[model samples]
Target chain A: MPDTPAIEVRGVTRLFESRKGFLFREHTRTEALRGVDLAVRSGSIYGLLGPNGAGKTTLVKILSTLLLPTSGSARVLGHDVVEDSEWLRPRIGLVLGGERGLYNRVSARDNLRYFADLYGIPGGEREARIAAVLERVDLLAAADRRVEEFSRGMKQKLHIARGILHRPEVLFLDEPTIGLDPKSARETRKLVRSLVSDGVTILLTTHYMFEAEELCPEIAVLSKGRIVAHDTVAGLRQLVGGDRTLEAEAYGFDDREVDAVRRLPGVSKVVSEEYGPRTRLTLRLRSLQTSPDDVAAALPGHSELSVRERRTSLEDVYLDLVEEEAH
Target chain B: MTTVEVPRISRSRATSASLRLSFLMFMADPQWLIPSMIAPVVFGLVAFELFRGSGPYYLTYAILGAGMMSMWGQTLYGSGWAIGQDREFGTLEPTVQSPTPYVYVVLGRVLWNVISGLIGGGIVYLVVLAAAGSPPAVPDPVGFVVLFVFVMLTLASVGILFSAAWVYTRYSGFIQNVGEFAFYVGTGCMFPVVLLPFWTNPIALIFPPTWALDALRYLAIPGYVGFGWGFWPDIAGAVATTAIYVAIASTVFKRVELHVLSKGDLSDY
Candidate 1:
C-alpha cells in the first residue's frame, strides 16, 4: 500500500459528441483522449504538458471526479474515479483557474467561506484555515475586498486559496499561473512546492516549460489525446536525442548539404525548418564529439553558414515529441 | 503513500451554508426583488378589480389566487434560477464536485426561496386587501393561515423537482420561461382547475400545488366545492403528491448529476 501510486490511470479514452445545424442536425464526435495511461507518485509534483485540445484538462476532470471517462479507468488514492468518487472528492482539490469560478459580487473571504462549508471544513478551524490559505497566497490584505475589484492575478490567488482550503492530499492545478504577473506566478510556484513538501501530490498542467522543469521531478507530454512521452526532464531530453543540441543556419541548404551534416559524428537526429528566406537545421547530438565547427565544415561553400550549440532544454524535448507526433 | 482520511460530509450543514450564501447573494443585489414582485402585484390588482362587485367570498378567491401566484414565482422560479446562475458563474462544477450531494445545496436555496415566497405572498395579500378595502370572510382564519403555509411547502417541493431540470440542461431557463404561463394555468394558480376542461383535471392533479391550493381555497372560501373531494381527501392528496415530488426530486437530482458528469458539461453555460 505504501508503494501504491497516489494517482493511477489506465487505458483512458474520452470522446466528446456535439450536435449542430437546425433543421437537419449534424452530430460530430471528437476524441479528446485516446488510451492515456499514467501514474503519479505520492508527494510529488507531476507536470502534464500539452498543446491546446490535447486532453490535459479532460484527464484532470476525469481524475477529479468532475467528468466520467468514456472508457478505461482512473484511480486516486486507490479509489476508482467513478465508482469511488464520493470517497475521492474530499481528498482531491482542483483549481481550474479562471475569472468565472469566483463570485464576483462577494468578498474573497466570503467565497472561501462558501467553499469551506461545501468541503466540510470543521466549523472551529474554518476561518483560521481560510486565513492561512489567503495569507499563503499573499491575498490577506484584500480578503474583505469584492472579487470584482481584485486584479486578474488576485482572482487567480483566490482560486488557488479555495483549492487548498481543506488541505487536500492531491491537488490538480490546470494552468494555475496563467494571467498572473511574474511575482504572483513565482509566489504561486512557491506555494505549490510547499504543498508538496506537506505531502500533497500535485498534477500541474502548464504551458511554461521552465516552470515544469523547475517544479516537477517528472512530467508527461500529451499530444493528440495521447501520452506521447512520460519521463523525467532529463530522460525526455535523452529520449529525443541527448543533452546537447546544435543548430545550423544559412540562406538555404541543399539536400546533399543537409545529408552531409546529418552524417557528422555524434549527430542523432536533424530537424529542418524554413523561416521565410533562410533554412535552419536543428541537430540533436548524442555526444560532445561533434562541435559547431564540425557542423559548419560539413556544409562548406555557403558564406552565410552559421552553427551554434547549447544544452538541450525541456522546451526542446516537448517540441520534438509533439512535432514528431504531428508528423 | 500518504493515506487520506475522508472528511465527514453533513447534508444539514451544507444545506445551511447554501441557505446563508443565497441569502447573502440576494441581499447584495436586492434589485431582483423588483422584477419578481411586479407580476404578483399586477395579478393581485387585476384579480381584485374583477372580483370587486362579485360576492363577499370573491375577495377570498382573488387573495388566494394571487397569493398562490406570488409564491409560485418565488419558490419555483427563484429556486431554478439559482441553479442557472450557478451555471453562469462556473460554480456548478466545484459545487457538484464537493462531497455533499447537490440536492442538499438546492434544498438550501429552495428553503430561502420558500421564505421569500411567503413574504411575496404577504405582499400580495396586503395589495389585495387594500384594493378590497376590507379583509375576506374566512370561515376558519387559523385553518386558512395554516393551509396557506402548507401550499408554499407544496410549491417548494415542486421547486426542488424543477431545479433538477436546470441542472440537466443549459436551456432550462428558456424552457421555464416558455412554460411559465402554462404552469400557472395547469396548476390553477389564478383560477380553479375545475374551471378548465374536465379532462384536463387529471393532468392538473399531477401537480401537488393543485391539490394544496384546492385545500387552501376550501378553508378560506365558504361555499368552495373543489374536485368533488372533501377537505380531508384534498389534504391527503396534497400530502401524497408532495411526498412523491420530493422523492422524485431526490432520484432525479442524482440522475441529473450523473448525466452532467457523463456529458462533461457542468461548467457549460
Candidate 2:
C-alpha cells in the first residue's frame, strides 16, 4: 500500500441510485463505474478520453477524493483517497470544469490569495506565488480585473494559473480547452506540455483526439464505466491494424454490390453512406490478408475506383472501440 | 506546474488569520448588515410606543428584547444565507477542498454575526434612548457583559448548524427562510415569550433566543426580576443554557456535513 503508484485505482466501482421519475415509484441504481483498475506513473501526462456519460468525470472525482468508490480503493501520492484525504489535499490541484469554477466577483489575484490562505500559505508568500503563476498564464496585466470581465480565453488561462498556483504535484485538468479559440487552444496545450516538463503529473480528460495524441504519452479510452483500452495512441490505433482506410466518392453505387465486396477475400470492414447526390464507401482490411488491388478488383464498371489501406488514427480507434463495445 | 514553495507560519497564526478573514468576509455581505441594523431599531420604536404608558419596565423589555432579536437574527441569517449562496454558486467545494478545517469557516461566520449584531444593537439602543428623551434605570454592568458573552457564543456556535438547512435544500431561498422562522417566532423577537400562554415557555426555552431575550430585558429594566429569578442566577442559567445549545448545534452540524460529503453533493452548489 505504501508503494502504491502516484495514482493507483484498484477495481473501483460506483453505483448511484437514481429515481427514474417523481410520480412513478421507480428507483434504479445505475453503475457509473465498474470494477476498473488504472495506475498513473509519478510524473507522466495521462489522458482519459471518452464520449459523454462514459464515467470519466466520475473517475476524476473519485481520484480527487471528492467521491468515494463503492467497493474498490484509490490512492494518491501514497495516501488513501478516503482515509488520508487531509494529506492528499495539499498535494493535488484540480481544475474540474475549467473557467466555470472561478469566482467571478473577485479579481484573479484575490482568488488565488484566498485559496493560498486556505492552503495555509502566509500573506507575502501567497502574493509571490500568485504573481509567478499569473505571469506564466500571461494574465499579469489583467490580474486586477474581476474574472467576470475576462474573455473566454483569458478565463481559461486563469483557470490553468489557479490550478498550478500552489505547485501541486498532480494536476487534474478536466476539459481545460473546451471553449477556446484555435490560437488559445494551441497556447493552452503548449502550457500543459511545459507543466509536464516541470515534473507535474497531469491527469487530463478531453474529447479532442488531436490534443490527446499530441500531449499524452499514455491514453486511456473510457466508455460506459470501463476502460476499453489504455496505452499510447499509436499502440491503441495499432489494435485496428495497418489497413489503409479508403473512402471513395462515387455516384450510383449499389448497396448490394458493396455488401458483396465486403464478403470478398481481402475486405475486413465496409461502411457505406449516401451523401447529397453521391454515395460514399469506407473500407478497412488487414494488409497481410487483402491487398488494395483484390478489393478494387471486386468493384466492376464503377465510375471511380479509389483504394488505399486504412492508416489508423486515434479517432478511428476510439470510434471503433466505442461502436464495437456498444454492439 | 511548478512546486511552489510557500512560506510556512505558526499553526496558531494561520488559524487566527483565517478566522479573522472569514469574519470580515461574512460582515461584508449585505443580507446580514441591512436587516440586522434596521430590524432592532424599528422594532424598538414600535415597542416603546405600544408599551411606554404601562411602565418603564416594558420600555426596557422592548429594548433588550429587540436587541436579542437582532443578534440571533443577523448571526443565523448571515451565516446561513452566505453559505447557501456559496453552495449554489459551486464555491463550497473549493472551500472544502482547502487544507483548513471546517470549524474555521464556521467560526468566521459566527464572529461576523456577533460583532455586527452588537454594533447594530448598540446603534438601536442609542437612537431609542435619544428619541424617548430619557433612559431607563440600568442594572448591573457586569451581568450585562456576561449576558452578552453568552449570547455571542450561543449564536456563533449555532451558525453552522442552522446553515445545514441551506445545504440540504440546495439553496432553495424559501426553504432557508422556513428553517429560520422558529428563531424569529419562538425567541420573542416577533412577540415576547413572557406574554405567551402557560404552556409556551417550555417550547420557547428550547431556543437560546428566548433566554437571550429574557437576559437582556432583565439587564435593561428597573426592578429587574428576571423570569422570577435574581440577577446572578439568571446570568448563570443563561450561560449554562447557551453553552448547552451551542454544543448540541455543533454536533448536529458535523453529522450533517459528513452526510453531505458521503452524498457527494459538497460541490452541487
Candidate 3:
C-alpha cells in the first residue's frame, strides 16, 4: 500500500520509427514522449493537457503498461511497470480513445459481463456490478441491445462500464468526451466528477482546455514533449495575468495593419483570422488596458474598426500557449 | 446509507468470468456452431460411402480426418475471430489492463474453443462411425485418452500463434482468409497428406491436428491402425513446434502491446 502513488511516471520517453518521406529512404525517429516525470496523487482528478502530437496519450499508455518507454521507468499503484506489470494491470482501468473499445455486435450488458469475467469477478458479483454501471450511465434499459444499434453516446457509456467493471483504483480516460454532443458531453462530465467523488484517482488527457478546467483539480500543460506549465485552474489563469481578452472586427484591414496592432504596448499576444471579407482579431492584454484607442491609434488609417473587450478563458490561454510554441 | 452489499473480485472469480465470456462469445455466433457440426458430418458420410467396398479402412480414414478438420477449424478460427474482434472493438487493452493474468485470459479463450472444437468434431466422428457400422479399433483406452490430451494442447497453441500475428498487423480479414485457406488447401484437411507432394507430406505431419486425425482414423476403423501408428512421429513434431511458437509469439505480442501503449497508438486510427 505504501508503494502506491495512484500513478507514478518518471523520466519516461517513447520513440517511434517512421519513414520520413518519399525521397527520404532512411527512417526517422519520432520521440513521442521525452523524459516526462509526473505523479498523480491518490483521490485526485489529474488533467494532462497538450496540443496534438504532444505525447499525452503516450504517457498514459506507458503508465497503463500498454507501451514500454524507450528510456526511463514508470510504476502504477506501487508496481514496477516492466517488472511487476501483471500486478499493475488489476489496479487500473483505461478507456482508450476512439470508438473501437465496445463490442458493436453485443449488448452493453453482455460486453460488461465479458470484461467482468476477464477481470475475474464472480458471476453473481459481475452481474451486479454490470447492472449498477448500466444504471449509472442510464443505459440499463438498452443493456440488451446491440452496440451497433446504439447512438454514439450509448457506445461511449458501455465503454465506461467496461473500464471500471473491475473497480480499479486509478482510471485513465483518454479523450473520453471527444465528438460527443452537448447533452451527452454534459452527462459524461458529470459521470467523471462522480467517479472522482467516489475517491478514484482519474487521469484524463484532452486537447480541449476547458474540459480539463472543469474536471481536473491539477492541470499539466504538455507541449513539445515537455511540461510547459503545471498548476491548478486558478494558477493557470494567473499565468495569463488578467481574466479579460480584447477583440476587434475590422473590414478592409490588411495583414500589416493587424501586425501593427499586435505590436501595441501592453499587448501580451495577438491572433488574427480572416472571416470572409473581414478580419477578426483577438488580443490578450492585461485586462481592459488594451482599449479602442489602442486598436484605432495603432491601426492608423483604418476607420471601419470595431473593438469589443471580453473576459479571458482557458481557450485564450491555450491558443496563446500553442502560438508561443509556434513562434 | 449503510451498504447492504458490494461486489469484490478475486483471481478464481476472474478466471471463471473470462472462461464464461469466451464460451458465450463462441456460442452466440451461429456461423461458428453450425459449420462446426455440419462439415465433419458431411466428410464422415462421404468417406464412408466412397470406401464402403474398401471396408473399415475408409471408415477410419473418414472419422479421423473429419474430426481433425472440424477441431482445427474451431480452434484456429475461434482464436482468430475472438482476438480480431477484441482489436477491432478496442477491448484488447481494457482486457489487458484487468487484474487477470494475460496467460489465464488467453488460455480461457483457447480452452473454450478447444472444447467447442471437440464437441463439433466428435459429433461428426460419431455420425460417420455409426453410418459405417464399425466397432472401435484401438485396443488401449489410455493411449487414446492421452492422444486427445496432447492433441488439445498442441492444437490450442496454434490459436495463440495466429493471435500474435493478428495483434501486430491488425489484419483480421487477412488472418481469417489465410487460416481458412490453409486448413482447406495446405493443412491436408480436405485430403490426406499422402496425396500431397513428398516434401509437403512431412510438413503437414508437423501440425498436431494432422496427427490427431490420423490417430482417430486408426482407432475408429479396422485395418487403418498402421496409418495412425505411422502418425505418432508427426504428433511429437507438432507438440514440439507448437511449444516453440507459443513461447515466441507470447513475448512478441506483449512487446507490441507495450509499444502501442507507450506511443499512445491505441487511439491512433
Candidate 4:
C-alpha cells in the first residue's frame, strides 16, 4: 500500500450548469473536467500546469473532497475522496489558490492551530506542529500577527503553514507560490523539496514552467479539461521532437513571408506570433541544413527588417502545445 | 529535528478551540461590537423617557425590548455570517474538507452569540433598572429565571434554524436582515402584537420567541397581562415550539451541508 500512488483519479468529470437569465432561462453546461484521469506517485511532487480555466483548480478541489466530481472517481491515500472523505481529510491537506483560504481576522498562529485542529492533529502535539510549520514557512516571527496585516506572500506562507501543520500524507497546492516574491518562492520550493524527501506526496499547480521543471520530476499539463502532456521535464521537452527551432523577432513579419519561409526545403513548420507592432517568427526545422540565413533572406524579401535566431525553450513548447489544443 | 507520529484531532479540543477563537473575534471587533451594543440600549433609554407618562408598562417593555432586539441582531449576525464569512475568507471549502465535523465547528461559532445574548440581555436589564430608577418587581423569581433561560435557548434555536435555511439559499446576508426585522416586529419585542390585527397574532404564535417574550412578561413584570393565558401554558408553548424548531433546523442543516459539499459554495451573505 505504501507503493500505491498517493492520489488516483479516474475519469473525473465535473460539468457545471449555470442558468443564463433570471427568468425564461436556459441552462448552459460548461465541462470543467472532461473525464480527467491521473495518478500521482507517492512521495513525488506532481505539477499540474495549464492556462486559466483549464480545470486545474477543479481537479484539486475534487481530490481534496472540496467539490464532488459530477462523474468519475478520485482517491487520496487509497481512500475514495467521496465515500471516505472524513477518513481522507485527516491524511491530506490543501492550499487552494490565493489567500482566500485563511482567517484574515485571526493571527497566523491561530489560523494554523485552527486548521491543525480541523485535521484532527492531537492536542498534545499541536503547538510544536504549528511552530514547526511556521518555522518551515519562515513565518514564526510574524506568527502572532493578524493575517490581514500580513503581505500577500506572508499570507501565502501562513496558508502553507496551515497545509503542512498536520503533516499530511498527501498535499494539494494550487499555485502555492503564485503571489510570492522570488526569494520567498525559492524558500517555499525548498520547503516543498524537504517535504517530498520526508515522504510526503505533493500535487502542485503553477504557471511557472521553470519552477515546475525545478521542483516536479513528473508533470501533467492540462488544456481545456484534458491532459495534453504528462511526462518528465526532458520527456515533455522532447514533444518539440528533435526539431531545431529558430525564433526571429521581426517588424513586418506577415503570413505571406511566413509561407515563403515554410516553403524552404528544410523548414518543417513556421509559426508567426504577434508582439504588438513586431512579430516573433518561430521556424521549426527538421535538420541543421535549414539555414537561418536562407530563412531571413526569404523573410526580408517581404519587408521584414532585421532577423536573428533565438533558442527554443520549455515556455515555447508549453505555449505551442496549449495553442495546438486551443485549435 | 525529529518528527513524532502525527495525532488525530480531538473533537473536544477542536470544539473548545473553535469556541474560544470565535468568541474572541466577536469581542475584538470594535466596529461591529460597539455600534450593535450601544445603539439599541441608548435608543431604548431615550424612547423609554418619552413613553413613561403615556404607556403604563413602557419601562419594563423598553428594557426587555432592547435586550430582545440585541439578541435578535447578534444571533442573526452570528448564524448569518458563519458560512458566508468562510467563503468570503475562502475558508469554506477548506473547512468542509477538514476532518472535523462541520456541525461541531458551526455550533462552536454560534455559541458566542448565545453567550452574548445572555450577557447582553442581562446588561440591558441592569441598564433599564438604572434608567427606570427602580428594579421591576418579579412575581415569580424562579419562574422568571427559568423562563429567561428558555428564551435564550429559543432565540438560539431560531437563529440556528435561520442559518440552516440561509446556507441553502442564494441570498445570504439579506436573509439575516429580513429575518431580524421579521422576528423583531413579529415576536412582539417592541410593541404588543395585540395592537396589530388579530391575524398577525397567529403569525407571531408560529415562533417560540414570541411565546418566550409573552411568558417573560407574565413571569417577571407585576402589571403585565399576557394573551389571557397562565405563565405555565406560555412557558410550555415556548419550550415545545423551540424543540420543534431545533429538530427541523438540525435536519435541514444536514441536508444543506450535503448540498454544499456536493455542489460547492453557499450564498454570499
Residue B62's lDDT in candidate 1: 85
TM-score versus the correct structure, for each prediction = 0.97, 0.88, 0.83, 0.89
Task: Tell me the lDDT of model 4 at B14.
Answer: 71
Q: Compared with the true structure, what per-residue lDDT tens digits does model 4 show for residues B1-269? A: 11235466577767776777787666657766653567557755765665576566666667677777677777657766765677676677777677887666767767667777666677777777888888765667687777777787787777777776656665677767666677788888766666778889989988888888898888667766767786778888988998898788878877787787666553232
* lDDT score of residue B237 within candidate 1: 96
Candidate 2 chain B: 10-residue stretch with minimal lDDT:
B1-10
Provide the global lDDT of candidate 1 against the true structure: 0.91
Q: How much lDDT does candidate 2 score?
A: 0.72
Angstrom error at residue B39, model 2? 4.4
Which docking category, incorrect, acceptable, medium or high, applies to candidate 1?
medium
Error of 1 at B101 (Å): 0.4
Model 2 ranges with Cα > 4 A deviation: A1-4, A19-26, A252-256, A259-268, A285-296, A304-310, B1-33, B36-41, B134-137, B140-146, B190-192, B241-254
Considering the two chains of model 2, state its CAPRI-style docking category.
Answer: acceptable
Given the true complex, what DockQ would model 3 score?
0.44
By TM-score, the better pick of 1 and 3 is 1
**CA-lDDT, candidates in order:** 0.91, 0.72, 0.72, 0.77
Q: Judge candidate 1 at residue B231 and give its lDDT.
A: 87
Which digits, one per residue and each the tens of the lDDT, describe model 4 over residues A100-130? Answer: 7777787888887777777777777779988
- For lDDT, candidate 1 versus 3, the one ahead is 1
Better of 1 and 3 by DockQ: 1
Candidate structures ordered by DockQ, highest first: 1, 4, 3, 2
Clashes, model 2: 8
DockQ of 4: 0.46
